[model samples]
Target: MRSAPFLGLSVAATLSGCAVPEARLRAGLIDAGLPQPIAACMADRMVDRLSLAQLMRIADLPKATASESVPQFLRRVRALGDLEILGVATSSAAACA
Candidate 1:
């Protein structure tokens, strides 16, 4: 019975970790010139679909300049050569836009 309480706490901690990455991703998307709504939506989708390693790879991508468009941002993502990441990013952008 004591283990059950520990399990609950662990579950909470795991779930909390997920939020940090999602919020950071949303901010990154906004910085890349996507509107806030689109950024939020796409971040949610990408966070749910991609693994932590894929997300970290995305986080490592060069920051988007102020003049960059969404398509331009996607081109950089495509260059990563991870088809799953590219697909999630493209589909998320399409759905969010």
Candidate 2:
């Protein structure tokens, strides 16, 4: 019985640690030059679907060039119709425009 409780606590702790804060994600998006509405929508949509690992990858994306804006990067990704991985849809892109 003690082991079961400890296991449950471990799982809860792991899951809590993996959660990406919505505000942080939103701020990251905005800092990357995405308009506020788009940033807000993307953060809200992604927080539920993306793992902490995925969010970290996005946050670490290289901003080496001015042309390589977040919206541009996302547009390229969306062009491949892979928004499901990002937890968004093409319709969400429309809202950003």
Candidate 3:
């Protein structure tokens, strides 16, 4: 039996959506302890390959949403205010999901 070489490509393409540019953000979010599910949603949301600058932009975003006792970095993320952090969270979710 023969299989389509690209059969696996669809998933690769789907994840390729933003796999590279979003690497840093993903790492950061993982470190931040953001729940896995929400993080996956954000990473899957990104479609285009980002420039290093754009990746930095995503990396620059915050992680922690609210509730002080959570963590300092999370609070910093909330204070800074950047939705891209969701990408980070999303990536983590992808890992566990």
* Highest lDDT scorer: 1
Q: Global lDDT of each model?
A: 0.86, 0.61, 0.49
TM-score quality measure for candidate 3: 0.37
TM-score result, candidate 2: 0.51
The best-first sequence of candidates by TM-score reads 1, 2, 3
* Candidate maximizing TM-score: 1
Model 1 TM-score on a 0 to 1 scale? 0.84
Compute the lDDT for candidate 1.
0.86
What global local distance difference test value does model 3 have? 0.49
lDDT of 3 by residue, 1-97 (tens): 2457677887788777556656665555444555444444444444244345544654655444542222444345545455555444344335444
Backbone clash pairs in model 1 (N, Cα, C under 3 Å; residues 3+ apart or in different chains), count:
0
How do the candidates rank by lDDT, highest first? 1, 2, 3
- In model 3, what is the error at residue 56, expressed in angstroms? 2.3
For model 2, the local distance difference test gives 0.61
